[model samples]
Target: MTPPDSQLPLGRRGLLAALGAAGLSASARPAPAAQRRLPLTAQTTEGPYYLDLALDRRDITEGLEGVPLDVRFTVCDTAGRPLPKLRVDLWHCDMQGRYSGFGEQGDDRAQSFEGKTFLRGSQRTDRAGIVSFGTVYPGWYAGRTTHIHFKVINGARAVLTSQFFLPDALSEFLYTQMPLYQRARMRDTLNSVDGIALKAGGTVLGAVREERQRYVATLALVVDPAAVPVIDRPPRPGGLPPGGPFPGSTPLSGARPPRPRALEGSARIRAMVPPRAEG
Candidate 1:
């Protein structure tokens, strides 16, 4: 049987080793800033698809088909210190843009996935403040770019709720070339035009690279461990609101305002490109 997270080592050397085992390097460490506290990761609405299934496993695919993706997250405090023992929950839609356990997804109102679970799982951070999940590259839906939703929980309180985006070029390449991702029509949104992606700025982009048969995406999440969870009104039964999952111009709202002409040329959008491998 696998050991518990508390049994793991947490020193700097041990942390680096653990990170390396998870396909990350010491370079994944957060750089020192002039200020003592780093900016907390931007928060966003959790959308209408989250369900606390209490599943504790690394592979959430459950035999689903698509390009393999290994998702890794390292949780840290505002001071860049690793924070261990926190529970990280992750979920995303499958290759057809359908979420498990939801009868209504996108425009498919008759679809039924009730009692099913896939691409959804939870893991506790090891001493290295890292948790990893084995899932597939997510599919896109109307009004949103390709993204994955995650939450950081301290005990019973959810300290952070946000979504991270995949690089548009990688996503485009897969959707057009991979037979599993082919759809009747191409995705309607890109990272540059996604409202939530624009609101999240550059920090939401995960560092991605190919490893053998699968791809790995890594994200460093700096958070305020003591932050109080913000409660938003529940979505209307059966689906999200008409405009989108979120409905406002605010940081946490999911409003789909007019596309900005300069977003594609902005530094934030440019950061969504996948980084080249270091020699």
Candidate 2:
């Protein structure tokens, strides 16, 4: 069982202490300087469609349609310093909210997209603590809103796993622009309605803007390169066995795996404390 936030070291409690002693207001102190890196992105459910395709490239969109989006993910430490030369893997649904390599997905299990690999790839961070991906804005599905998944790794140690969400207005705008996405029935879930977004204190939302014909979204994923990921175990091929479930799903009795190593000290800090949301 997960411990309460208070019991967790370098968690919200430590953040509160710093905020109390410092005379700065939350709104006044921004997270990053040029592109301020936040401390550890929030850990979300890996879902049922995370497959390491072994394709490492920046451009993952294999001839999809929608507003082209350039995603910039910056990795940094808790001190707001950038960490260079790290591996970051990113994946998301296509313009129609259908993931590649998955036969079917969604709440009602209505999709039949199989062996399709698009808008999913891996890249390593540069000297500036960033991994830029050239892809299109993702569409929505039945139960979840518009979002993307990412994982940061150091050697074999999985340090962090998280998701980034886009504003509803942007998602709504894209659906109207592309006729193909219009067929994907819009769900009731929005970023604000997502439980993980709320718990992470809105840090999970990507700061996006339009640049000429394409949209550029940027967000910092802070993590400790040395810390073990706060997941049940390393990501397995095709997610779990046939009956095995995702993180938030009901597990089959005696099928659940042991939790990953207990996070210690400020490693817990990077895993626990959500970065202050920035515009």
Per-residue lDDT of 1-279 in model 1, one digit per residue for the tens? 112334222232342232232221223456564456766777877877789887999999998878888999989987888899999999999877888877766445567787889999999999979999999898877667889999999999899999887766666667766677788776667765677777887667777766756778888898888999684434633434222443233323444344222232345334344344699
- Stretches of candidate 1 exceeding 4 Å from the true structure: 1-28, 33-36, 233-279
lDDT (CA) for every model shown? 0.72, 0.62
Per-residue lDDT of 154-199 in model 2, one digit per residue for the tens?
8776688778877554554456545656763444445544455556
Collision count of model 2: 2
Candidate 2 structure lDDT: 0.62
Model 1's alpha-carbon lDDT is 0.72
The deviation in Å at residue 214 for candidate 1 is 0.5
